[model samples]
Each structure stands twice: as structure tokens, then as C-alpha cells.
Target chain A: GPKVLQIPSHQIIDMGQMVTLNCDPVSNHLYFYWYKQILGQQMEFLVNFYNGKVMEKSKLFKDQFSVERPDGSYFTLKIQPTALEDSAVYFCASSWGGASAETLYFGSGTRLTVL
Target chain B: QQQVRQSPQSLTVWEGETAILNCSYENSAFDYFPWYQQFPGEGPALLIAIRSVSDKKEDGRFTIFFNKREKKLSLHITDSQPGDSATYFCAASGQGTGSKLSFGKGAKLTVSP
Candidate 1:
């Protein structure tokens, strides 16, 4: 099965500090996505990127958040000046295409705790 | 607003019994529905899926019964086992919506063997 690998299974950062979460998506995957999940809550979509550009973003994608996959490298999500409410598990997922039926391969997720 | 909704926040079923999980969606544009299974400390994985065109889809012990008219669906796990214990999330997407999936607050299932 295809695998999406997330770096640093857990991260503890102080509020107002910047944090970067890294993801190594499936090699052949072209579309990348980041989702946030709080305990016992739904997985909320943050943003989706394709062709080096952001395709769509949800309200949860705050202005402080940014995503980039520099030169075909690891897709990264960087959050500046993190807030306490930003504490959640962030899962990275990738798909070969953006079609409705395309399957998404997700990483185990990075548990970010903003203290 | 939640585009997808699921019932029974938590359920416990005994082994060999059938467990049914219900889901509904608010968007009429959604045509693709997928069920994802997640265990503790792990990301959700695609367990089974069905399209709006199909009324039923079966895969081994797992089955999906869809009602396009009512905008509802259900996943039935027969002959459940302890390993089947996990949180199941119902997700929806549509052609015009690209691949962004709207997921429901998952239903946690506990299978007692």
C-alpha cells in the first residue's frame, strides 16, 4: 500500500512560536492536503495544494498558516505565531489526482501541542 | 455547518454480531462517499466506499447500503471481531468540489470478543 510519512510524530511548541510540520507523501501522488483533527471531533480540512499552488482552503486555514512543496521536495505546513487552539493532530494526505473518486493516502499524523 | 453527519457517537457490539453505522449528508452535489477506519494513534484508512449510483456495495464482511433519495447511507459489519474496533468516519465529495472531502464526526465502535 502507498504510504504518506509525517515527520516528528509529536510536537510541543510554545504559543506565538512558529512550527513546521513535514510530510513525505506517496512519490507518485500529485495533490497534497492537510487536515486538522481534535480529539473526538471531525477531521477538518485546512487546505489542498496542486501544481505548486493552493487549490482550495477552508475557513479553518488561518492567515498564519502556509503550505509549500519546494521544488518537488517534502510538503510542509508552517504555522507562524501558533495559538493555543491550534493544538491538534495534523494529518497529511496525498492523491494521484484531484478527482472525486481518487483515493487519498494519509500519514499517521503529527500531534501538535501548543502550550 | 457540518456537511456530513453520523449517528451513534459510540457503540459496543459483541463478536459475531452485526454492527450498523449510519451517515447522512446535507449536500446534494456529493456523489462519492467513502468510509474511513481509524485506530488509536493512527491516521484514518479507507475501509469501504460506495457511489451514489449504487444502492448497495459489499466487500467481504463489510457492506454499504446507500439511499440516494434520502441522502443517507449505512455501513454494516457482520461477524464482527475484536480487531474491528475503531472509529469510522463517513466522508463525502463531489465532482465539482474536487477532492476535498467533508467528513463526519466519526462513530466509535467497540467490538467485544
Candidate 2:
């Protein structure tokens, strides 16, 4: 099974501080994604990246959120001046292709808490 | 608007009994459906999936019955075991949506031994 690794399983940050979540996707994966899940809600798609560009993003992906995979290194999600509503578990996933039929491998998830 | 919906938010079944979870989608473009299973403190993993073209798919103790015309599907887990207790999420992706899956709230299953 392919593995996607997420750093900092749990993160606690002040409401106005910046935070970055890192992901190490499968070595051969081409498409990367980030999803957010509240304590009792369904996992919602935030954004998807491919070839250095954002392919698609949902409304949940706020203006303060950004993603990048610089120089084939770790895929990172950065949130500037976090808000209390940003508190949730973030899961990173990757797939070998951009097709709907392609299987996605997800990381354990990083639980973010804003105080 | 939740594009994908799952029913019976929670279910309990005796060991060796069959557990059925149902799902339906509103989007007509959705062609791929994948069911994921998650244990507490862990990420969801793909259990079994079925394409719109197929009416049924089976993998060992798990089977997916799909009704393409009805835009609905169901997962049946037979011979349930305590280890199978977990949350099951039904996800969908359309042709143009690629792998950006829309997930359901999930159905929590408990297997009583």
C-alpha cells in the first residue's frame, strides 16, 4: 500500500498565528490533495494540486490558505493568521493519476486546534 | 448541499451477521464510487470500489451492489467481526472532478461478538 505521511499529528496554535502542515506523498504520485474534517462532519475537499498549479479548490479553501510542493519536496499547506473556525483535522492524499478512477492514498492526518 | 449521502448513521450487527450500508449521490456526472474504512485516530483507507458501468463488485467478505440508474449503491459486509467496527465513508468523483472526492458523513458500524 502506498503511504502519505503527515507531520505534526497534532498542532495547537493561537488564533492569529500562522501554521503550516506538511505532507510527504507517495514517491511516484502526481496529484496531491488536502481535506478538512470537523469533529463530527464529513471530510470536505479543500484543494487539489498538480504540476505546480492548483487544479481545483472548494469553497472551504479560504483565501488565507495556500499550498505548494516546491522542487519536488514536501507538499505543504500554510494558513496565515489562523481563525478558530480553522480548527479541524487535515488529511493529505495523493494519487498516481488525475482521473477519478485513480486510487488515493491518504496520510494519518494532522489535527489542528486553534485557541 | 451534500452531493453524496449515506444512510443509517450508526449500525450494530451480531458477529457472523450481514451489515449493509447504503449511499446515494445527486450528481449525474459522478462515475466512480469508492468506499473507505476508518478506525479511530487513523486515516480512511479504500476498502472496495465500483465503477458506474458495473452493477456489482465483490471482494471476499465485502460486496458492493450498485444501481447506476438509481444513482445509489450499497456495501454489504458478511460475517462481521469485532475488528470490523469502524466508520465507513462513501465517496464519489465525477469525470471532470478527477480524484477530488465528495464524501458522506459516514456510517459507524459496531460488531457485537
Candidate 3:
């Protein structure tokens, strides 16, 4: 089974600070995604990235949120001046292709806590 | 707004019994449905998936019954074991959505031995 690794399983940051979550997707996977899930809530789509560009994003992806995979190293999600509502577990996923039928593999998730 | 809906926030079934989890979607464009199982402290793992062209898909003890017209589906696990206790999420994606998935609030199942 393929695995996606997320760094910093738990993070606690001040509400006005910046936080970055990193992801290591499967070696051969191309498309990458970020999803947010609050405790006891459904997972919500944040954004998807492909070929160094944002392919699609949901409304939950706020203006303060950004993603990048600089030099194919790690897919990172950065939230600047985070809000209290930003506290959630962020899961990273990747697929070989950005198609409806492609299977997406997910990471364990990075739990972000804003205080 | 939730594009996908799942019933029975939690379910309890005896070992060796069958457990059914129901799901419905509001979007007709959704053509691919995949079910994922998640345990505490772990990521969601793909259990089984069904395409719009198929009404049923089975793999081992897990089966997915899909109704395209009604935009509903159900995942059935037969011979349930205590190890089967986990949260199941129903996700949907459509053409041109760039493979972005809309997931339902998961149904947590507890298989008692």
C-alpha cells in the first residue's frame, strides 16, 4: 500500500501566527490535495495542486491559505495569521492523475491547534 | 452545504453479522463513488469504489450497491469481525472536478464479538 507522510503530527500555534504543514506524497503520484477536518466533523476539501499550479480549490480554502511543492520536495500548506476556526487536522492526499477515477492516497494527518 | 450524505452516525453489529451503511448524494454529475475506512490516529484508507456504469461491486466481504437513478449507495460488510470497527466515509467525485472529492460525515461502526 502506498503511503503519504505528514510532518508534525501535532502543532499548537497562536491565532495570529503563521503555520505550515508538510506532506510527503507517494513517489510516483502527481496530483496533490489538502483536506481539513475538525474534531467530530466531516472532512472538507481545501485545495488541490498539480504541475506547480492550483488545479482547483473549495470555498473552505480561505485567502490566507496557500500551497506549494517547491522543487517537488514536499507539498506544504501555509496559513498566515491563522484564526481559531483554522484549528483542525489537515490531511494530505495524492493521486497519479487528476481524474475522477484515480485513487487518492491519504496521509495520517497533521493536527493544528490554534490558541 | 453537504453534497454527500450518510445515514446512521453510528452502528453496532455482532460479529459474523452483516453491517449496512447508507449514503446519498445531491449532485447528479458525480460519477465515481469511493468508500474509505478510518481508524483512530490513522488516515482514511480506500475500501472499495464503484463507477457510475456499475450497479454493484464486490470484493471479498465488502460490497457496494449503487443506484444511479436515485443517487444513493450502500456499503455492506458481511461476516463482520471486531476488527471491522471503524469510521466509514462515503466520497463522490465527478468529471471535470479535477478529482476533488466531496465526503460525507462518516458512519462509525462497532463490531462486537
Candidate 4:
């Protein structure tokens, strides 16, 4: 099975600081997505990106959150001046086509802790 | 409000028995349903999926029974094993929704040997 790799499996940052989570999606995947999951809760859709543009985003994607895949490198999620509620496990997923096309491959996840 | 709902927050079944997980959705526009399995410390993995046009889908021991009119579905796992203990998430997506999936809170299953 193809795999998506997420860097820094665990991160602890102070509130109001900027934090970036990186994901290495499958080499041939075209669509990338970010999802957040609080402890003992459902995974919530945050945002999806395609061809250097945001295709869609949920309300959970706050104004402070941004995503980019510069120069075909790692896909990154950056949160500036983070809030305590931002602490959660972030999972990155990738697919060959859009949501209706194929199954998504998800990374192990990056656990962000805000203090 | 949660668009996707799953019943039995936790379930316990004996090995070799059948385990049924129920799910219902509030959105009639959702045409795609996918069930995911997640173990501790790991990301969710796609177990099986079905489209609105189909009433049932089977893969190995896993089967999904879909009722389009009722907007309900269930995942049936036959011959349950201890290794199958994990959380299952039911997700739905509407057409041209840009691949954004609305997921249920999940049902944790424990298969005892």
C-alpha cells in the first residue's frame, strides 16, 4: 500500500507561537488534505488542496491556518499564533484524484500540543 | 449537528462471531459512503466503500449493506478476530464535494478470543 509520511509525530508549542506540520504524500497523488481529530472525537475535515489552490475548506479551517506545497516538495500546514483549542492530532491524506475518484491514503498523523 | 451518526459507541463480540456496526446520515445529497478502520497510534484506513447506486458491497469477510431510501448503512464483519479490535468510522461525501469527508464519531469494537 502507498503511504503518506508526516514529520514530527509529536510537537509541543506555546500558545501564540507559529507551528508547521509537514507531510510527504504519495509520489503520484494529486490531491492533498488535512484533517484534525481531538481526543476521543471524530476526525474533522479542515482543508483540501489541488494544483496550488484550495479546492475546499471546512469551517474548522480557521483564518490562522494555511497550507502550501511549494515546488512539489512537502505539503505543509502552518498555524500562526496558535490557540489552545488547536491542540489535536493532524492527519494528512492524499489521493490520485478528487474525493469521488479513489480511496485516500493517510499519514500516521502529527500530534500538536499547545501549552 | 452531526451529519453522520453511528450507533454503539462500543461493541464486544466473540471470535468467529459476526459484528454489526450501524450508521445513518442526515444528508440526502451524500452519494458516497466509506468505512474506515483505525488502530491506536495509526491513521484511519479505508476498509470498504459503496456508492448510492449499489445496495451491497462485499470484500473478503467485510460486507456493507446500504439502504439508499433510509439513508442508512451497516458494516458486517463475519468471523471476527481479536486482531480486528479497533475503531470504525463511517464517512459520507456529496457529489463534487471536493473530497471533503464528513465522519461519524466512530464505534470501537473489541473482538475477544
Q: By DockQ, who's the top model here? A: 4
The digit string of per-residue lDDT tens for model 1 on A1-115 reads: 9999999899999999999999999999999999999984799999999999999999999999999999999999999989999999999999998737788888999999999
| TM-score of each model, paired residue for residue | 0.98, 0.98, 0.98, 0.98
In candidate 3, which residue pairs get closer than 3 Å at backbone N, Cα or C atoms, i.e. clash?
Answer: none
Off by over 4 Å in 4: none
- Looking at model 3 chain B, which ten-residue stretch has the lowest summed lDDT? B93-102
Model 1 residue pairs with clashes: none
Can you tell me the CAPRI class of model 4? Answer: medium
Q: In model 2, which regions exceed 4 Å deviation?
A: none
Q: Quote the lDDT for A6 in model 3.
A: 100
What DockQ does candidate 3 score? 0.77
Q: Over 4 Å off in model 3, which ranges?
A: none
Q: Quantify all predictions' global Cα lDDT against the true fold.
A: 0.94, 0.94, 0.94, 0.94
How big is the positional error of residue A88 in model 2, measured in Å on the Cα after superposition?
A: 0.4
Encode model 4's per-residue lDDT on B18-108: one tens digit a residue: 9999999998888989999999999999999999899999999999999999999999999999999999999998776557788999999
lDDT of 2 by residue, B1-113 (tens): 98999999999999999999999999999999999999998889999999999999999999999999899999999999999999999999978665599999999999999
Query: With candidate 3 superimposed using the best TM-score fit, by how many Å does residue B30's alpha carbon deviate from the native?
Result: 0.8
